[model samples]
Target: MKFNVLNLIFAIVLITNCDIAFSQKLAVIQIEDLYLTSPPIENKKTSISYLVEPSDNIVIQYYTCILNDEFSTCKSDDLLSSGETEDYSISVSIPKDLAGKYLSYCISAISKSGAYLPSENECRSELITNGDIDNKNALFSYLNQTKNFSLYNAPITDAKDDVSFVTSNSAALSLSSEGDASLIGYGSEVTNAPNLPKAKEVYSMLDGFAIKSESDDAIIWGQFDTTPSYINQVEEIFPAPYAMAAILKDGGINTAGDMVRGGSISSEAQKRIDKLLSKDGLPKAIYHTAQAFLAVFDMPSGKQKLVAWGQSIYGGTLPDEMKSALSIKDIVTSQDSFTVLDNDGNAYSWGHSPFEQHQNIQTVYATRYAFAGITTSGKVKAWGDSYYGGLLSSAAIDFTNTNPITRLCASDASFVAISDGNKGVAAWGNDYGAGYIPSNIQTELDATTITDDFHCASTEKAIALYDSSHLFVWGDKKYGGALPSNIPTFSIANVIGNNHAFLMKAMDDVYAWGGLNQGGCIPDGHQCLSSDDSSLNLRSAINDLSDISQIGSFNTFSEFEEEVVGGFYVRGSGAVVMWGNSVPDGVFNE
Candidate 1:
């Protein structure tokens, strides 16, 4: 029975008296799958997103009350807050007074005919509130304790103000409703630009690269750089060696680079792009090399396909049949070519096929001018410019016969293949670049007994590793080929090397030895080792060493030549350290 009801009490009454006569009749509505998106917090807004069946003319009624005990009774007048909604979601303000106490909430839906779910009278949900998470560190701790560490897994947006929040260890980043981004925390600053959108999702790398998607995509590092004016919507951003490429929502590509421009897209590829745009295709994934971009698209026909385009300076393009997503499993690129390994382990070359067909390929590695692969059977092969490690040496063949290659690492012009158990090692490439291992080092490689913790790092001049209490260096001596007599031997956690220097992070301290100007020497005050002695100190100019997570390398331009010269250390606490001969010239504090 239905009557024009002006209050919730009458609605409840109508629901209770099912047999009562009314002026008009309506069907009862049902609601299911009721659940809370997240726990309510004290002095904070709690959002409840809901979807109910027979959505039309449905109303959501909710109320919250502080509970005294498990058996406490809640009266209608005891409701601390109450609200009604016709939309799918609602946010309620949890009062500060409720902190440290349990709160019960009742959420139900009723149809226009006064029919409701949950019959009447009982609250099915109770939650304890944690006092306000007003700071980034506290918020992260709460998320960690609750095991909901991914803060941005779901979009968090304030509809009325259009503000979004992004958190890092040191600060909270907010995009205001006015499209201004402000960093709030220790040493906080604001970059005022009336251009940023209320981001739905923002992706960031510790090296100061960030991009916010969902609307009018823009790049934010230390400063704001909006996407190309022609791009209406951005799906993803791919940072390549010398350029940045963005896949557009319309299946088109936009790029900012020295040699390649989105406007210069090939006519043939453009036609395919237009077809996808017309059908509203979706961008799936993207891969890029210095010279080319490969995009995967989900088409309207329910087929996943690939498209490739670039300068093609070295003949890089996918085969017609290989354009089908199923035909390719992985892709590796050399400076001028692309090698696609099919699912069956057969390899195909598009840009420069300098080698014969290879099968059963487990993995492939590349140098600037050559390619090498290790077969599933542990056999190794190489091809391309013989001068640049393209031709497998007799030593490689002999070494593999006794012990199959377990892994491979490369320098600009050399390849180092470590045999199984790391008991043996071999190299080939330009002789000056450490392509030929000295006989004495080979003897050491044979005698050294390696544990499961074996690690190898390579650079243009040498490879370094821990052997007992002494760090061994082998290769060209000009850079790091010779071990420094003053360097102490310690258990190393990780080691990384660039063109001319190496940084070793020991269990508690970090050590460096190589070209001083190229990052081999730790700047004064930055060392974890005190100036008086080699003892480890928790604090230094480099921050806390015990919390360091990993070290990464980045490319920097000096004297008009691009070189991978800098090392950035990311700490477990989200603090980052950038060190090297040259750091990018810009405000990186953001």
Candidate 2:
């Protein structure tokens, strides 16, 4: 809690476990992926996916190590290498002896030269065991905790401290649409990415949606079903690189963003907002909503001003208190959470504050669930509980004392902070899976950051804009590698991430990877070109953008699916084309 008497601010999103390597070698051999049964047991089948350099012969070995505090090998298997395309899949059997125990394992590829490359789970997985909690001991349990996940039923409806219903005090948190697209109110218990709020049948469901993405939910703007005239007015106010947004048109207000199109604010929230907007009315909305933080730019009294709102939960509405607490400046959401920074350089934080106590602060950077602040003394402070060593780990915190962090981006579990001094990037967080960044690219992320005025983005992975506006990536390659071998880097106007990639090239062209099977990234009428190697939506409007003003992308991730499973995209021109496993059949067909 150190104070330097200066002001500063920061954005949150969660991530899936993934790692993709970017290599530039004469011959590269990589263990691209390894998927196995969740909580595996005896006789269950396990799998591995990998990549080998072109025309190279390689051998892959599956190695297993003891789970509980070990330093010894358990079993190993050597297998023939396919040395095939990036999307190859292979399988192995789970040993019965490892049932119930968490064993660490990995796949190593042996090159024709006997050179070996090892996968870094040093890979870990747990198998269901025969042991069960003693029934007598369970009877005396404290919270009646179960084996793993537990659901608390008959939830008390009233708790003064409960923030979920804090917006009940407002009139908008519960409102539904009346005229067009009325069915956008509720659904048949559909699903989205893990931890992502379900899509309500309202325009607000589209809040924070974008056009090219790697999310796990489907966002089909009104244009997908029936075109709405108000869409024509979207850009004049809510413009490019849009985030969580609220719109007022034809006597109605709805939500908009990179991941969704339009939906109504809950009734309670609307009422709360009605009170505040009694004089001038609700403002248009955010340009793009990342990290779930919302903001609007307005010209009050002839000068352009930024108005921001914080902590917009499900239903795309912020609590009444948040809007009321807003002041003069604008703030963007961290990937899906908030990093509270004040004008006095003092930060108020709870559980795991990323800042060091008694350290003067300059600014704070928000990870999906944590916060990292740059002290005026040029050091960093990360607060909040980190699930993996990827975040705030000693290896992740290797910041040089002389360099100051200039900007940052977050995947669901990691952080990519750029150095102002041109040294390199400071990245840490769920360093496994697609979030696993390439070792050599660390220099690229750093060089790209210090050299350009660009933005960083992520999903299960991460990508940053290089000097040419073309992209330089680390993290997982499914989304990162999807970038065409020859990107028109100099023309890239904007870029964002779901750890998958979406870009605005030449300020007119668009390219994406991750959710094309569902039409999330592919433009209409165009053949599927997703980086994940699926060909589903090749005839949608998004695939055919020309003279387009701007683009936005959205996605959700399912830990249960163990992969990003849904996505959709939107145009600043009001085109809402969606694609993903979660999308309705023929939803985006012309």
Candidate 3:
């Protein structure tokens, strides 16, 4: 046997070299693409990414743990090799008062030849309060220092960084400047950026105040404390001798030096007659007459008297030949008669129908018992008591044809007209709907104009005016024609009566809407006279009127009681207002 067969081949080569040094002293470490590029430090700034693989004589270490609440690991961080397969980046700055929670990381590889590597922990991440951090601690610190690594439980890929840190102070990390810094392409450190103002200019610059009229977009200003008690109830219900003799006889000024050189009175009418004579003063038995070249002021206990024939009818109480033959230039009245139009328009009347409705009358309209007139070729007349239908009896007219009338209105039994080439509108007698002339308004008969309301129960809805000044109404909307939603379509020019519907406006500006009781509407300052109202509760009480230049209306009565029958009238330097109920105060202070 050759030495016992060589001792079994040297014991099989020392048992195969002790199984190759125990399989090279047990080694295994792998980590790959671990990532986290900002986003996960609840109280703010963070970034972490890595990749490594080391096995042969390995050594890779990165560890951090702060677990507690029974999750155990109190706090750690040290073994950080960061060498093999090294690809790492880390930044963590969390502060907003860093409240706790679990956070663990591990990737240990050591095998430089004295090998004993088996540590690739990583799956514990969760520092959550705001959540973020999972790329398995940067891909297990990159395949635990990768060698010929093969890992299965892989997870660690989260990268989305538009660079954010809005304060938990890492120097306040937020760079997305101007216009969001060109939408994150970054390039804006600040340029012209100072904003925050308009809340009415920051409350008018914190109340140092200065915003008067940036063009007065008026939210509201002043002037309306019930407007001087509605202008002292329109000067105590349209007085001033029936509104200055219905504006010098309907403002065409028939005489009395055209109501004292009529420039249409209104520079606030001498400050509204010196504020109503300094608040109810003047007026008492002021007489200066010479054959009725009158100037009597009375009224304050003296029953009633305000007779002044034109120019200063004695406010200075004169008698110098009755102030030089009644230097009166105009004065007319009717509730029983009194007239004067001297200044050469010469006309006068006494009392009691003195010539029937005051013959030769320029305008007038009484009614305690009847009277009416209109002439100067506009023809219309009426007398008293035809049993309260007054008088305009052409056998109660059914239109036997007759024109040439340019306005005339009566109510309380009917009468209306606005003739001249059938500009349409006609009516007559005893309330057959007042004067019943509407076959659909005779096919719009060129409807030049028309108006009347006799307190209107239905004068075919009374209220009309056309020739394109359009303003049509049909029968008593409780008094006049209602209409007023903010009135814009304009175009009326003239139409009076005011228990409600007044309307003037070719810039003469007047406009009253309807109802205050049969007076129909006026009530804001009151005005409008001369147009039908012997009684209809005296036209509801009148309302609203302002600086007019002129206006008129009437139906009958003329033997010149200074005239007014089918009524209407207006004029406005200062006064001359009327609205039915038969105006008379010597046709306004004469």
Q: What is the TM-score of each candidate against the true structure?
A: 0.56, 0.43, 0.19
Candidate 2, number of clashes: 118
lDDT of 2: 0.36
Specify the poorest-scoring 10-residue window by lDDT in model 3. 201-210
Local lDDT at 396 for model 2:
49
Candidate 3's C-alpha runs over 4 A off are 1-296, 299-302, 311-391, 395-436, 439-590
Clashes of 3: 101
lDDT of 3 by residue, 1-590 (tens): 22322133233333433444466556445554343343335566554455546534444445443443212332323111122333356555554533345443343444444444344433224343433111111111101111111111111111111121111100011222221211100111111112211111000000011111122111110111111111111110111211111111111111111123221233333343344344442422111111112222212342222333422321212223222222222343322334433322234434333332133333333232343444323355655455323466563333323443433444433445544334455555543323444455455544443322111112112444432245544434543444556643355454444222334444444444444322233322334332333232222322233455544322111222223222233434433444333222112210
Global lDDT of each candidate: 0.51, 0.36, 0.31
| Candidate 1 lDDT score at position 388 | 68
Please give, for residues 1-590, the per-residue lDDT of candidate 2 as tens digits: 44211111000000110111333233344443343323234556545434444325554444444353222223322121212222344554555665435544444444434333323222333333322211110110111111110011111112111211101000001111221121211122121211223322222222112111122222333222232222322321222122224344432234433333223344554564555454453353442223232333232332222232333431134433334332221122233333333323454332122322323444555444455665533456665546522246564466634454544555555566655436566666666522345766655554543643444544554445454444665555555534555456666555544324444435465566543453225534345544433443534454464335433333232222254444444332323344434333222211
Output the TM-score of candidate 1. Answer: 0.56
Per-candidate clashes come to 0, 118, 101
Q: TM-score: which candidate is best?
A: 1
Sort the candidates on TM-score, descending order.
Answer: 1, 2, 3
Could you say which candidate leads in lDDT?
1
